[model samples]
Target: MEATVASLVEHGWAGTTTTAVAQRAGVSRGAQLHHYPTRAELVIAAVQYIGAARIAEIREQATDLPTGPARTAAVLDMLARVCTGPLFHAALELWTAARTDPDVRAAVVPLEAVIGRESHRLTVELLGADESRPGVREAVQQTLDLIRGLGLADLLTDDGARRRALLADWARHLDARLGS
Candidate 1:
């Protein structure tokens, strides 16, 4: 799965062949085929696998999060890291592929919906957000969208300094809104 995600990040959707993944993983082509019979299946499964792993990692990290004013900033920082990580890159590749490929789109749309919901839920939990309040839910979703845009921008250039500055501003606004 690591090899598959790495392939997607490095080579993109068109280049991430099962044979290539097998080669990178040091496994036989037959072995790879045994698990994923088609490229769509392989790509979809890889994205799902890596996405789940990344979410698990974020949950584990959330345990030691700081308290008080700094906590919101820390949560934003953690979310930024996640949005820029390999899993997001892999998902981006799949999304690009899905734009023109109906089969891939059929698979990725629901998969992304699930992942996005999970990510949103996790963010709300990590930030101790109360969605019952006015605009709180939209604020959280906007935070994810903003971070995703930053992640997309980072794909071309570093975008780190700018991302940090923007996220800091966002964290302040979010902290006030969420009362975290």
Candidate 2:
């Protein structure tokens, strides 16, 4: 699964094949085929696997988030890091493929819905966001969208310094909006 994600991040959807994953995984073609017989199955399963793993990692890290004023910035920073990692890159490859491929779209839509829901729930929890309050839910969703947009921008260039600046400013605005 790690090799599959690595392939997606390095070579993208067009180059991630069962054979390539097999070779990268240091497994025989027969073994790779036995586990996942087709490219769609392999890539989809790899994304699912890594997505779950990364979410679990984020959940664990959330425990260490600072209390009080700094927590909002910390949560934003952590979520941004999640959006910038290998899982997000691998998922981006799948998303691009899904744009023109119906079968891939069918698979990716549901997968992303689940991931998106979990991410929103996690973010709300991390920031102690009161979604019951008017506009608070939209604020959380907007924050996720903003980070995702930043992640998309990162695919074309290394904009870490700029991204950090933007996110830091966003954190302040968000904290004020949320009354955090």
Candidate 3:
């Protein structure tokens, strides 16, 4: 799975073949074929595998953060990191490929939905915000959307400075609204 994600990020979805993944993983081609009979299946499994690892990492990182305004910043930082990270890039590659390939789209959409829900749940938990308040969920969703857009910009060029400025501005607004 690690090899698969690395391949996807390094080479786009078109280059992420089962043969390439097996070679990178140092596994026999036969073994790779036995495990994943089709490219769609392999890609789907890799997506799910990486998604699980990412969710676990997010939960683990959130565990140690002190709850307060600090936690809010930490959570935002974590989300930003995820947006700009290799996993997200690999997922983007998959999404782009899925657009033209019905088989890939069928496998990716449900997994993407699951990951999206999990991300939202993680953000809400880490934010420790009062969900009872109106607009809280919408605010979080908007923050996510902003981060995703920034991350996409990063794919084209270095946008760290801009992303940081935007994040800082959003953090202040979120702090005021969410009260932490």
Candidate 4:
């Protein structure tokens, strides 16, 4: 799966093949086909493997934080740490695949929905509420958009400060909007 995913990432989905993945994985093409049978199956498995890895990372980062703003900060900060590498790369490749391929889009959409729900769940938990106020969605979008934008920026730039500022700013915004 790692070899398949890396190959698909380096070469687009259309360029990757079972034979190629087998070659990269040092396995027989027959074995690869036996396992995956089709490109769509392989792509779906690759996405799932990547998403599970990401979820584990999120769980690890959130393990130490108390629920509320601290937990939210921790989650966002961890995302900041990974946004430039695998996370960003995965997002780019999958989203690009999604644009042209319905099978890929269908595979990715549910995973995205899961992440979206998880984000909202974390936000609600952080705010100590069952539901976010109207501002919560906007705050999340702004933060996610900023993180995505900055992921490609200079690595030497102050990401910690930037993430911290965003977290603080989002908290204030949510608090003001929620009247809490």
The root-mean-square deviation over C-alpha atoms between each candidate and the true structure, in angstroms, is 1.5, 1.4, 1.4, 3.8
| Candidate 2 TM-score over all chains jointly | 0.93
Q: Assess each prediction's global lDDT (C-alpha) against the native.
A: 0.86, 0.86, 0.84, 0.68
Pick out the ten consecutive residues of candidate 3 with the lowest summed lDDT: 65-74
- Candidate 4 stretches with Cα past 4 Å from truth are 8-15, 65-73, 126-134, 152-180
How far is 94's C-alpha from truth in model 3 (Å)?
0.8
Candidate 4 structure quality by residue, lDDT tens digits, 69-143: 454556556656656665556656777889888999999999888876775565455445433456656666665
Estimate the TM-score of every prediction: 0.92, 0.93, 0.93, 0.70
Candidate 1 segments exceeding 4 Å error: none
- TM-score sort, best first: 2, 3, 1, 4
The Cα error of candidate 2 at residue 54, in Å, is 3.6
lDDT of 3 at 55: 78
lDDT of 1 by residue, 53-100 (tens): 777877876888899879999998888887788778887887888899
**Clashes by residue pair, model 4:** 68-126
| Candidate 2 local lDDT, residue 157 | 83
Segments in model 2 whose C-alpha atoms lie over 4 Å from true places? none
* lDDT by residue (tens digit), candidate 2, 1-180: 989889988999889878888999999998988988887787678768866876886898798899989999899888888888887888888888889988778778887788888989999999899888888898999999999999888877897999999989999999878876
